[model samples]
Target: MADIESATAQKLLKAFMQFRKTGWHDKKISGHNPSEFKVLATIQQGANEKDYEMKLSEISQRLQVTPPTVTQIINNLEKDGLVERTVDPEDRRAVKIKLTPTGMEATAKARIRFTETFTGLIDYLGEEESEQFADLLTKVQHYFSELNR
Candidate 1:
């Protein structure tokens, strides 16, 4: 039983690693790398949530990256006219980040691409299996979250 469990665990780990590696390879949209797309997506999500804008620190935290890294990315995005930085009205010293019109269009394209990819996965996995996979993943995520606490 221990050997069987070990084999299962190893297979699961291998599958997860491979999935992470390949997941983003073919998902690029509008010539933006995954990191840039992630930042754009995060800001867009915040806006959809009625936040309208986000702080650098908030973006860094959400992306699980350091502030400097996020700042650099945002700077590049700004240069490409994909995002804009403005002074935060509520906090005079802090700045807020928001998507430019170009960013919105790029984000929309990326979102459509993402949806198609996931829908393909659902078709392959079958609806019931997809739901099961999602539930299992959620449970595993919660387990890891608990471990960090």
Candidate 2:
């Protein structure tokens, strides 16, 4: 318990807080927030993999968010003319979601912007450090994931 207040622990906490203050996660890619873009990307990927519309539950599972949260995001995207929902042909009770042509265009642009942003980050960090950073981040994520369990 005493080690929790050590200089190293304090530095780590401060650094994490400073990182959160950077607003990287809050920044919009294209006209949508990162979460929205992620949902869009997931649908796009699902389409590529299955050649079919994604179900709301599938999106929720992939994004690790609640169905209601996904519904809210889908509602916003639909309102923006970016996505559309339809009844599943094989399962009348299920709703399937697909990107609109407008959604596809926006997603393409957003993908480019997202890649460019990360590319800039990689360039700044250089290859070796960027790789190390990615590995460290993965380790940190796994640690926290395990901790939560």
Candidate 3:
């Protein structure tokens, strides 16, 4: 039992390292630097057009950073024309962030490149093995998430 657990940990660590290396993710994905891309991605994920646009507080929470840190990133994104800041209609004290069309385009490109890279690697593994591998990783993640909480 101990040996199996040890092997699982080793396997997960190896896969994480491989992802970090193979991710080859540069900051300059869309003519924007890494920081800019990160800010754009965060806003893109948090924003909902029809509903409430994401608040700066929400961005800070998602990034696990401080409000000031989120503000700095948002400022840069605003300058790049990837995002916009609007006065929150419901909350006079908070501002909402929304993605501009350019931001959407850049985020889409980044998602595509990442998916293509992931698909290329998955293509090398057989179907059953790939399914087994995914299942095992999911179990490992669940285990850690449970322990951490």
TM-score of 2: 0.92
The window of 10 residues in a row where model 2 has the poorest summed lDDT is: 1-10
The numbered model that scores best in TM-score is 2
lDDT of 3 by residue, 1-149 (tens): 44636988789678888988875665366476666667677777765434436888887887788899879888887887878889887888998888889878888897676567568768888677888889998998998999999
Clashes of 2: 0
Q: Return the clash pairs for model 2, or none.
A: none
| Top-down lDDT ranking | 2, 1, 3
RMSD of 1: 3.0
Candidate 1: tens digits of C-alpha lDDT, residues 83-133: 999998788888899999999999999889878988999999999999999
Score residue 78 of candidate 3 by CA lDDT: 83
- Best candidate (score: lDDT): 2
The per-prediction tally of clashing pairs is 0, 0, 1
The Cα local distance difference test for each model comes to 0.90, 0.94, 0.77
TM-score of every candidate relative to the true structure = 0.77, 0.92, 0.65
Tens-digit lDDT string for candidate 2 (1-149): 54868998899899999999999999999989988999999999999999658999999999999999999999999999999999988999888999999999999999999999999999999999999999999999999999999
